[model samples]
Target: MTGSPWYRDGRMRYGVGIEDTFIPQERIGHRKLDEYELTQHYARWEADLELVAESGAEFLRWGIPWYLVEPAPGRFDWSWTDRVAAKMQELGLRCIVDLMHYGTPLWLENSFLNAGYPERVAAYGRAVAERYRHVWTDFTPLNEPVVNAEWCGLTGSWPPYLVGDDGFVTVMMQLARGMVRTQQEIAAANPAAVFVHVDAGFRYEGETSPVPRAFLDERRFVGLDLITGRVQTSSVLGEWLASHGVTAAELQWFRDNAVKPDVIGVNYYPGFTTARIEDGVMTPVRSDAAGLRDLVELYSARYGGVLAITETSLVGTPEEKIAWLRDSTAELTALRDEGHDIVGYTWFPFFTLVDWLYRYDQKQPDEWFREFGLVDLVRGADQGLERVRNSAFPAFRELAIRDR
Candidate 1:
C-alpha cells in the first residue's frame, strides 16, 4: 500500500475472493443466482472478511452488484457497499473490485444488447470510482468477456438469448466498447486506478477443421486483443469478426481508444480449463501444473505484462485441492524465477458457489453447490450455509505465509 503500487513492490501477493455473481432472473423466469445472498454473505460479510484476513492473504478480489447499487437509472445506493469498503480498509486488504460481473439492472432491457449499454455502464463505473477512489485502486471493468459472450450470446442460456457466430460477435463488440468506456471514465475520476483485465484462460486440443485449432487459439485472445487494439482487418480473428458483421469503423474505434491492462489476470481451473475435441465433440480433459505453465507462457509471450492468476480452484476432495494448490503455486514460482512478471495469485470463491446450472435446473441450492474453496459450505439446522474449514485452508495459509 506504499511506494510503487502493489504490482511493482517486488513481492508476490496472495488473495482470496468470495463468489459474487449477480445475474438477475427477471428474463429467465427463475430465482436470481446471487452468490452473496445464497451464501449468506449479505448478513455475514464482516465474518467473511475476517476469514479472508485469517487466510494470510493481503489482497481480496471482491465485486459490487451494479444492478443492486444502481437499481434505477440515474439513482444510486451505496449504503451496503460503503460499509464493505470500510471493512476491507480496516482489514488492510487491497481490493480488485469487479465493476461488472455479467449482469445489468432490470431497467436495461435486453441486457448487454441494450443500445445504451456502453455509456450506461461507463457512467456506473465513473460513479463507483468517484465514491470509492480513496479506499480502492484496482478494478476489473468486466470479468471474462469470452464467457460472457459464450453464455448470453452463443449458447442462448442468458439474456437477449442470441445464438451462433453472429450472436457471439454482437455480444463481444458491445462488451469491448463498454469495457473501454468504463476504463476511461474510471481513469478520469481516479488517476491512480489500476485496471486488471481478467479473463478465463481457455485451451483446446484436437483436429483442425470446421473450427480450426489455430482459429480457436486466436479467438481466445480476441477479448484482450479487441480491448488493446490488437485486432485489425488484416488479422485472422479480425477477418472472422468482419465476416460476422463487425464493421471496419468499430475496429478502428477500438484502435483509437485502446486501454491496456496493468495486469493481465488469467483465471484457470485444472479440472475445467482445457478441452479435447474428437469427432467434433468437445470434451473437457483434466489439466495439470504443466497446463498452467503453458498458459502463463502463452500469455506472457503475447501480452508481455505483469500477470496474476485471478482465479483457480478444483471441485474435489481436500487432498486433491491441496495437491493442485501445491503444484500450481510451484509452477508459478518457477515462472517468476524465469523472469515473468507474476505478481499475485487468488484462490477464488473463498467458499462454495452455486453452479450456474442451478439457474436452469429445479433443484435445491445445496444440491447444486460446488466445493472449490478453502472452506466447504454445509447446511446447518437453520438451513443457512455454514463455512467449515477444510484441510486446504491450512495448506494455503502456510503457502501464503511463506510466499508473502
Candidate 2:
C-alpha cells in the first residue's frame, strides 16, 4: 500500500485475456465436430500468443479446458495447457492461467457446483499448481462467483442449472471453497504458489421481475462472504444469508478459514450493468460506465486487498473503444492516486468473441462478430500488424512508458 501496486506496477501495467484473441470453445451438445476445424483453431492460438507477446503488454491471461486435463478421476493430461504455457514463457510475458472460466470440464459433470466438488477441484489444483511450478505463476482458480451462480444456478440457463437463492449459495460455496483449498494445496506442495482471486464487477438489480432482483441484490454473496471469512454476529448480510441456503454453520467455516486473496483480480465487465429489468419491467435504473469506477473502489474498501480490472471490452468502433479505454484508464489512474492497491489493468479479449450472447445455445455469427478486436483477427496477416496501430494502442503505450 505504501508503494505503487503493492506487488507489480510499471506505468500501471496493461494486459488482457486471450479469448477472442485466440482459441475457440468446443461445441457442447450435438454441435458437429470436424477435426480439421478444431486443429486449425489450435494452430491459430499459437500464433495468437505470439501476438499477445508483441502487444507491448506485461501479461497475458489464458486457460485450459478442464475436461481435457482431467478426462476422468486420477487421469491428467496437460497437453491442453502445455502449448499456451510454454508459448507464454517463450514470449517472455507472464501467464495468468484461468483454471475455471465457465463451468466444469464437462467430464466433471459440472462438479465444482457439486457438494464435494471443491475436494476434487482442489486435488487437481494442487497437482496442477505443482506441475506448472516452473512456468505458470499466477492462477485465477474460478471466475465471477456472483455472476456464475446467478447464470448457472439462479437462471438455470447454464449446465446443471438450478434455480433458487439457496441453490445459488450452494454452488457458489462449492466454487469458492474448492478454489481456495486448491491454492492452499498447491502452496503446500510448491510453497511459492500465489493466487490472484478474479471476480466479475458490476451492479445490476432486475428490471421488471421482482423475482430476479429480490435475491440478486441481497442474497447473491453468501458464499463470497463465507469464503472471505467475514461472517460476524452483527453482520446484517450474514443473518439474511442464514435464512437462505447458507446457514450459520457455513458462515462459521468461512469466517474461521478462507485464505484472503493475494491479488483480487476483478473482471470488470460492462455486462455487469443493468439487465432483465427494464423501463416497463422492473425499473429504469441503469449503472453508467463511469459509475463502474465507484464500484471498483467500493470493493477494494470492503475487502483489504489489491484490485485490478482483469477484463473489459465493448462492441463498438475502434475509436469508440479507445474513448472507453481512455475513460476507464483515467478512472483507474484516479483510483491508484487515491491510494488503492490497483496494480494491474486489462482491455480484455484483445479481440471479439463469437456466439457469447448465444450462451452456446446457437452458433450463428451475429453482427458482433464483425470487429471488437484491438487488433482485428487479420491484423497480422493482412496489414503487417501495423493495421492495429490504432488510437487506443498508443494511449496504452504512452501510459506504460509515462513517467508517473
Candidate 3:
C-alpha cells in the first residue's frame, strides 16, 4: 500500500488516535484503567494497524505505554515499542508518537505532583527519542495537560488524588514544567523532531452571571498559556497560581524556558466543546460547523501555526457518524480554502473503545462499547475480539482517497 507520508514532510495528514491511557487508581483498589487491555490492543496490535491503514488514514496517534516502558525508575523496556515501531515503518504508516498519554510509572510516587516529576518524565522522553531518533520525527510530550491536572489534582481521580485549588495549581505547574523539559530533551536527542502540542479546545457560555463565565473562559487557556510562556505574573491564572502556592519565581522559570510547538493540535468533541450553564446546569450544545470553524480561526490567530483536528468523533449510530465525517471534512476544507493553514482532519480511535465509564470501573453491560471507530469490535466465534466493519468505514475511506 502506498500510504501518505508524515506531517513533517509538508503533506496534509489524516490520522486515527489509538486509545492508549494507563491510570492506576487507588479508589478502585489500585486497579489501573489500561485502555490497551480494555480495547485489546495488546493482543491485536498488528491487526489493529492493518485496520488503520485499510481505513485510509495516513498517520497514527499512538503511544508507547509509559508504565511498561519505565516499569521501575531507570529500568527501560523497549521490546514492545521496538516491534511496533518496526511494523509501522514497514507498513509506511507515519506515527505521531504520544510520549505520555495520561499516566505515570508506578515507581514515581505522587505522579505529576512529585517534585522530580518534570525531570523524571523528561528522562524517559529523552531515552525514547535517542533510541528511536532515526525512526520517528514527531511527538506529543503530554496529552491534555489541563484535563490531566483537573482529574488527578482537583477531582481526585488518579494517583496522588489531591483535592483543592492548591492541588490543581501544583499539578498544572508540574505538568507545564514536565512538558517544557520533555521537549527540550527530545529536541536535544533528535534536532529535526516536530512537537505537536495537543489540548482540549472549548468555549463556554454562562446563562446567568458574568463572573463565572469570565472565570471559565480564562481557565480554558491555562494549559496552553502556561506551556507557551504567555501567562503574565498579573494574569488571572498567575494570580490564582500565586494564591495557591506557585511562586512568582516558579512562574518565571516557565516563561524563561518556553518551548513553542511546531503544530497546534486541537481535540474537539462537540459534546464537550460548547456548553450552556443554564440555572447552574451544564448542558451540551448540539454541534455546528461554526464551532469547528471558530476554533481553527481562534487558534490560527493565537498560535500562528499549522492546525490539525487531532481527535473528533460522535458517539452514535453508523449513519450519524458518517454524516459527521462528511460535515467535518467540509468545514476543514472550507477553512483551508479561506487561507488558513488547516493541514489535517482525523477520525480518532481507529477501532472501537470500551466505554470511558469503564475507567471508573462502572460495570454496565456486555454491549457497553463506544461505537466511534471506523470499525466495530465484536466477539469472534472463538470468543476473542474481531473487527466488524461499520458504515462509516466506506465514508471515511472515500474522504481519505479524495483528500490523500
> At residue 143, what lDDT does model 3 achieve?
89
The lDDT for every candidate, in the order shown, is 0.90, 0.64, 0.81
The runs of at least 3 residues in candidate 2 whose Cα sits more than 4 Å from the true structure, single-residue gaps closed, are 1-11, 20-41, 205-223, 271-289, 359-362, 365-370, 378-398, 401-404
Displacement of the residue 53 alpha carbon in candidate 3, Å: 1.1
* lDDT value, residue 149 of candidate 3: 84
Better of 2 and 3 by TM-score: 3
lDDT of 3 by residue, 1-404 (tens): 12442453455668888878787544543356787887788998998888888888888899888888888899998999998998888887878899888888878877887889999999999999999876788899998887888787887777678787778777888888999999999999888888888878777755434337877777877888888888888989888788888888988888999889888898887666788876656678777777888888888887887788998987888898888887888888878888787777778777777754565555732455877788888876886778888888988888887776
Q: What TM-score would each prediction reach against the true structure?
A: 0.97, 0.83, 0.94
Off by over 4 Å in 1: 27-30, 278-280
Best by lDDT: 1
lDDT of 3: 0.81
lDDT of 1 by residue, 1-404 (tens): 35687798767889998888888855444667788888889988998898899999888889998888999998999999999999999998999999988888888988999999999999999999999989999999999999999888998887768899899999989999999999999999998899999989999866645677888899988889999999989899889999999989999999999998999999999987999866657788899998899999999999998999999999999999999988999999999999999999999978999898788767888888899999888898998777799999999999889977
| Residue-level error in angstroms, candidate 1, position 137 | 0.7
Counted clashes in each candidate structure? 0, 7, 0
Residue 298 of model 2 has an lDDT of 64
